[model samples]
Target: MSKTVTVSDQTGTEALAAQLAAVAKPGDVILMHGTLGMGKSAFCRAFIRAVANNPHEEVPSPTFTLVQIYELDRLPVWHFDLYRLSDPEEIHELDIEDAFADAVSLIEWPDRLEYLTPENRLDIHIEPGSNPDGRVFILEPSGDDWIKRIDQLSRDQA
Candidate 1:
């Protein structure tokens, strides 16, 4: 099963991110999909902040760095932006292996992962909503673990 959430503004998006963060754990993979300005990076920032339990936590987009690892007491969070990725094989250089095996991973431009993408993951596709400032998030869980975990989401607005 999947869940769809509609939010009227950026605050709503951030709230949803925080809610998801409350249920996330180590080794969970979140694949973000959307075009430019769809707030893919914004979602990741909010998620990382929530996981850190620090609303002021700095969560810079990994657009240039490719990967940003957030060290937390619960577990590390690897935020990856593969927009500049020239080759899927380059993911190794970003230590994606470690992210997949031991940490919570938030990947933007996940299509760039190519064959390196994990099978067990929660794919979040962002789309424009009815209003100009509104947004729609389609969350699809893959693999048994993800499917079960997704049910724990607090969102039922869909």
Candidate 2:
């Protein structure tokens, strides 16, 4: 199932992230897909700050490091940027399999994972909106759990 949310600026994007944070938990995997200059990094930064419970926390993009782990009060977060991955085999080296069981994972360029992606995951595709500084988030859930959460989000937004 899928849902779409449109935001007009950074604050709107962050607000959406914070709403997701309210329902996020350990073992959740969110795959982020978007072209460069899209708001993937900004969204991830906001999500990370929300999870960390520190609005001012400095959460850098994991573009070069591949994966950055953050220990939050409620659950650990595994942020992965697979854009620079040379091969899918490299994913095994990062031990992401372990993150899927206990941590909340936010992955960028998850298309690089190919078949390695979990069956129960959330796919978030972002794109530029019609207005300047606007963004559209296309959320597709791979499992019933996320579908229910999305429904709740819809009701809340309504």
Could you say which candidate leads in lDDT? 1
Candidate 1, residues 108-135, lDDT tens digits: the string is: 9999999988888999999998888789
**Model 1: lDDT to the true structure:** 0.89
| Stretches of candidate 2 exceeding 4 Å from the true structure | 155-158
- Angstrom error of the Cα, residue 104, model 2: value is 0.5
- Candidate 1, residue 79: Cα displacement in angstroms equals 0.5
Query: Which candidate should be chosen as best, given TM-score against the real structure?
Result: 2
lDDT of each: 0.89, 0.88
Error of 1 at 64 (Å): 0.8
